[model samples]
Target: MTDSFLTISGFRKTFGSIVAVEDVSLNIPKGEFLTFLGPSGSGKSTTLYAVAGFDDPSAGDISIDGRSILATPPHKRNIGMVFQRYTLFPHLPVGENIAFPLRVRGHSAADIAKTVKAMLSLVRLEGFEDRLPAQLSGGQQQRVALARALAYDPPVLLMDEPLSALDKKLREEIQVEIRRIHQETGVTILYVTHDQEEALRLSDRIAVFNHGRIEQVGSGEDLYARPATRFVAGFIGDSNFLKVREVERRGSAASAILPDGTRIENIPAHAGNGHAATPELMVRPQSLKFVQGSGAGLAVKVKDVTFLGDTSSVLLETGWGQEIWLRGAGSAVKTNALSGPLHVEWNPADSHLFC
Candidate 1:
């Protein structure tokens, strides 16, 4: 943490009576790929804007390499930004568009041409410099935008949902390109997006935001496996929540009674009070397995089955009418042949307790 290249400490932002971001802070190392991931209006974008010097924070400080930049104007921050919409100048050709940033920085014409060529090669669009923005496809235009952003060789790059405008296939393709560019350039990047898959695919560490606050920040596996809050567990991945009443507690973990009176133990009580009066069981579909007959678990009836090529998802309803889902290998569960009673069982350690 002492070697942090970018630091956001106690950041808070407000607009009139509305508080957009509050109490947000993070430490990013040099050449790190960190992502701000959350639903809309969760303050992710607001935090990024503050770092870019677009809006001054009501409280807290933002520093790059230990120097505060709160008073710096947006244009003087030397940060590159790529927004959701393509902001290319319509009249400028692809090559010139990438050269615009260099020209603004007063680089010599000879140096600008060299940088433009390198950027074009970096984005894998070497021969399209003569093409106009309108004449290029959406994916190609976004690539050019990326090339332009990197042309100036800014130490920090901020991306605000840059891939939101493209289709799924194109979006995925660009995600790969972004990763490659990050590796080749080694520039510290702060990317913003709401897509869980995209965040998991791209970030080395992710900060989850909600209602102007950061709920959690960690590696993809850490957040997915050991979430600190109920909201984080539900938001970062697919989860099925089952209502449960607290049966007992010991130390930091607790036990709870399921709907069918089956007891589950060793669940982490993240509330840290050693007690959760009203706790819900968070079980992933992949953790549940179909049992042949009723044992020490919840018995449910098959409601529906969906085959998704590599895996099949089975929807089950408890006797109390609560729905639960289980994912299995594609050939493991027959969608049409599924019939009769099926019980769902899981190891207590595989489940989480959230109150």
Candidate 2:
């Protein structure tokens, strides 16, 4: 943490009566790809804007390499930004657009041209330098925007949904380019997006935001496999929450009875302070499996089955009329199997208890 390149400490932002962000702090090491991921109005952008010197925080400090930049102007902060829109100048050709930043910084013409060429090659737009922004496709324009942002050799790059405007296939393709650019330049990146899959694909670590605060921060695998809160568990992946009543508690291990009176033991318990919140068992769809007969499993009736390419989705209704989904191998469930009573079971270790 002492070597952290970007540090956000006790960050808080407010808009008169509305609090946009609340006491969020993070330490980002140099050259790491960190993402702010969450739904709309979650304060991820607010934090990023503060770092970019676009908005002054009501409280807290943001520092780069241990030096505070809060007193600096937006352009004087020496940071790069790529927004959702490809903000390339329409009249400028790709080469000139890329040279804009370096030109403004008073770099010599020779150095600007050399840097533009290298940047074009970095984004894989080697021969398109002569074309104007209006003549390029959406993906190509965005690539040019990226090249322009990196032209000045900024220490940090802030991307706010840079790929959100493209189609799915194009977005994925550009994601690969973005990753390569990050590696080639070694510039610290702080990306923002609501798409969880994109965050998982691009980030070294992700910060999940909700209601003006960070819910959790971890690797994609960590967030998916071992979520700290019910919000995080539900946000990062597909989950099924089943209502339950806690019957026993010993430290972090506890036992709970399902709605159908099936007692499950040794599950990880959280926030069990006997609050008004009801206890629920959180299980991933992939963790639930069909156990042969009615042998020590929850009784359910199959309602529907959907066959995806690599996996099949099976929907089942519990005896108490709660519906849940299970994902299995493509051939795991069949249409003919829907006629009889089905029982599903999961290991207690694979579940989390939340109240």
Candidate 3:
């Protein structure tokens, strides 16, 4: 059995009339990096708050290593937290800021010194110890906040879009730094972010939340390769959805009739995302091929073509009036050549059902 460092079962939270998180359950393996990914009002941050003890649950239990911590105060929970903004003291130096948590915990001066030194090394902020928050760069100050969070040696780390304020390049850099720190320390990390790329790039597992509930929980590959529902399929990545016009079942194999009178045989997408809302099947741009043969491919009229230097994206309108997006790499294909007639073909397995 995998050892769960944190297990949240049926955890719920409500703010007056609004339900922020409802009966969400998940098991986070020890030392594994888990991320809560969803858009705003989807309850990703609310779940993190429940785990951090900032908001007590309206129902259910939050256990760390098989013991309940629902009653534990925020300070007593021993969690490391990095918020969206760098919450460092403006008047204090970097060293003093990182030492604040240790000071609060009543550590000896010598012990604080040792822990601070180790944390600085871990976050690669060793030399910036003397610099004040205003003196250091944005990335450096962010690293100081991360170092401070780690100073207490908390087993679990909670990050709520810590790098959201930085530019893309700096954000990527700090993301790598955080990954390195996690690998080096083997601490259980619970990250929350609305950025899909960040979740895909950082987590051992990505739990997609929707409307105050967990929609799906699995590795990045699991989400992209096999999304549990249409919400997850549409939210986790870029996908083109086409509604299922009809479905024909035969034994274990099934077929779905598409909008263009095309049938996809022996595919699970025929039923859509199992018992949930019947949505259209998603056809990824990368999974499509421009073919010239007798197949069940949808015929389309190329409306526009964009040159992306290395790659090109084609926008088209199908005979069924559905817009199709295709991505490929070649001599930037002109829109004029593809304007008259175009067909999109792919393997049946590439279709992700939305029903």
Candidate 4:
């Protein structure tokens, strides 16, 4: 939330007749961990490439510390980048790999040696200095890549799915290291990933991209709890959207009736430009609760239930044949008792009416 340290203004990129990225603009503060999150071909990588000088923008400007970097070449930009694959020099040892950037910048041998030692220690690879890229594990190789990228003490670091090559456990382990390095080094990081959980765990703020445009930007909680668009609602977390009818809107508060004549009132609603699409009630799986009687809530027949460690996932079918999921404490409902008819209800305040 500080003054803008890295700015992208009206950035646009196109490939022949197709548009890769629209006019995307964002202001990033110094030392902020911002993530560009979206599915593949959603313009996240295109924006990151523009920042790293890998691709030229058809329009708009990219500035760092109040100076435009559009005219600067990639090497002169002094920016660091790590890609999906580990781009380590196979013939060189870890120490030399970490020292490559420092050498390129014309640092003294003594300075390079000192920085290499510190960088190795920062990545928790203290004694692996003499090991080659082939000798180290995938995660360790990435740590070395990270060390190499930071060797020149760049002002900003750009990561493009750097952990996608690692296994789940290794990926999670390296995520912790990345966070620690970010805190210790205080470098502004622009990370790109399609994994929502990764973005939620790592970013100080997330920019959700969709179809060559940025749909929303906010903290994980903000996007999950109050999404500005239906796409964001469906992307940020697990959501169950039930079709609703007879929507009456007055300001931000609205009421609607379900297909089974269950009335919900005084809920937050978004009537998008007075469109005629059927409004949907967006609710999280955890927000629903099972009641005993049919008169209390929407009547449903339990289709299936799966016990998942600390939680239970229940799949239910409504009278109109719409399937929805409900997740709750594993011990809340017995497996044997869930087969019959049940009623599911949630607080009206917990749902959003999205048109």
Q: What lDDT does each candidate get?
A: 0.89, 0.90, 0.84, 0.91
- Per-residue lDDT tens digits for candidate 3, residues 1-355, read 4877799998888999998887799999899999999989888898899999989889999899999998899999999999998789999898889999989878999998888888888887777778889988888888999988888889899999998989999999989998989999888999999999999999999999888888889999988887877788888777888777876766534678878787777665533364555557787876777777545487777877888888788877877888878888857355556745767777777766555
lDDT ranking, best first: 4, 2, 1, 3
Candidate closer to the true structure by lDDT (higher is better), 3 or 4: 4
Query: How high is each candidate's TM-score?
Result: 0.95, 0.96, 0.94, 0.96
After superposition, the stretches of candidate 1 with alpha carbons farther than 4 Å from their true spots are: 272-277, 335-337
RMSD (CA, Å), candidate 2 to true, equals 1.8
lDDT of 1 by residue, 170-222 (tens): 99999999999999999999999999999999999999998899999999998
Residue-by-residue lDDT tens digits, candidate 4, 187-288: 999999999999999999999998888888898888889887778888899999898867888789888899988888888887531243778888899999
Give candidate 4's error at residue 230 in angstroms.
1.2
User: lDDT of candidate 4 vs native?
Assistant: 0.91
lDDT of 4 at 294: 60
Residue 25, candidate 1: C-alpha displacement in angstroms: 0.5
Lowest lDDT sum, 10 consecutive residues, model 4, at 270-279
Comparison by TM-score, 1 against 4, better one: 4
